[model samples]
Target: MSDGEELTLADEIVARARIHAREVIDESELAVDLGALEWDVSARARRRAGLCRWHADREVATIVLARRAYERYDWPDFAGIVRHELVHAWEFQQFGESGHGDRFRERAAALEAPRYCEAFARPRYVLRCLAADCDWRAKRHRASKPVKSPDQYRCGGCGGSYEVEHVASGRTWTTASGYGGAKSALGEEW
Candidate 1:
């Protein structure tokens, strides 16, 4: 697509959200109502596709999209996430509250938004079952507590210990060696 023909994700969100907002609550100045709607990208969000937060003090709503989710999903699929967050914004504007309750679900249905986003799949870590006989393993996209401290966890299949490895670097850490040159979780020094 040409640069002129392209809209950044943030711009696309505002344009689509403006139209969707009007549909949810009727107002000629709903444009202005949604002018307070802000868009941001979140690098730390692991599981959720998007978040809608209302700032009571500022009387504004900010929608944050997960950077990994957007990178993995096509625009069409990601549009559903935008719609879901918009439903939250609409609910707050009209009902003074927003959540996964009856009203939110009804509004979400009318907007064709999904109830929940799919799991993030860009795996950065690999968890391997250390039982010599057990071949079970998992690919993880986030460095969650369990993934970071595999020693604290046991494999479900063999009840064996685990080894965590960085996918790209092939750096492996096990209970015996302690990860990151330290003798345990975090590091040997810490």
Candidate 2:
């Protein structure tokens, strides 16, 4: 095949995989009904691909696919990786943190996407971080460590602030801010 033709086919494969990922997420009914989510595809050379983020206030989520991984793996496996990441987004919305703890694992298993932590041992790309209101721009880099606690950043537009902290170990999330709306960024209404 011509180089151009091969590249086009590779691109198509990745595109199809991303669509499958979204389909799986939609079918799970686990993700928040944020109307529509965004998808991005790029090569590993570009550095900032194969990541996903969810913006709570905006009710939007974005997925980034690494171009290299897309070209190397089959569509089903690639889609599986995407679905795995989407689970983090769902967990973040329901709880917080894209951790691989019991709750995250349980939810992922419920969606038929079990944890493949060992897969990360290889030099393969990752679909990382599924949190709302996080602007973790894509880069061709792997996090040296998993995120321990969710971040707390302020919004430039609305001046609203939110913090994502882990509930106790083995505990699920509930909409309770110890100090009421005044102390919680999500507010009492949440």
Candidate 3:
């Protein structure tokens, strides 16, 4: 009976994903009732955009979307992510299990849903080259392999060394400081 008093962000994500599911899929062949499925948004989903969780009995299933995905992607791309998760749902509906299997691929291709969702990460670090005439820089959302010890790598543009900059505070993060410790500005020792 209330207009906007009790809605959360998950409500919005669930509502929109349901709409996209209907628009992109024809559920007549599916044993799982798409209309009766539960939906939710995951706050801790950093590596993936979507997921389909099926109960052990396979009689119930839920499609979960990543909260950060909506913040990072545009509508069309977001819709594809919803579709990708739905393909998993569709597969589970038929076989009681789901993965990036062959049948899932066929349905995904027919429905124009991507087989995989683009990864979601917020750019927290930047690798900049100090080459005399080169202006090369790479944005890294996480401290992955290449960012672990940036000084150990050379810029492809001119074989120059790198300086890792922390995007949040506009300061250069010392590579030797490792990932967990508080990043020191340019010259502070680890």
Best by TM-score: 3
Task: Give candidate 1 misplaced runs (Cα > 4 Å).
Answer: 1-9, 20-36, 40-49, 66-72, 90-110, 119-121, 126-144, 154-163, 169-178, 181-190
| Model 2: colliding residue pairs | 42-67, 47-139, 47-140, 48-138, 48-139, 48-140, 54-132, 55-133
Ranking by lDDT: 3, 1, 2
Model 2 poorest 10 in a row by lDDT: 139-148
Model 2: per-residue Cα lDDT over 69-149, one tens digit each: 665566556666676767766665665456778877887787676475223213322222334655432211332222112
Better of 1 and 3 by lDDT: 3
TM-score ranking from best candidate downward: 3, 1, 2
The alpha-carbon deviation from the true structure for residue 162 of candidate 3, after best TM-score superposition, in angstroms, is: 18
Tens-digit per-residue lDDT, 95-168, candidate 3:
68898878888878876788877678757788888777899988777777667777667886788887777777
How high is the lDDT of residue 146 in model 1? 68
Candidate 3 deviant stretches above 4 angstroms: 1-6, 27-32, 122-190
Please report, in order, the local distance difference test score of every candidate based on alpha carbons.
0.71, 0.51, 0.75
RMSD (Å) of each candidate, 1 decimal: 7.1, 16.5, 6.0
Cα distance off (Å), candidate 3, residue 147: 10
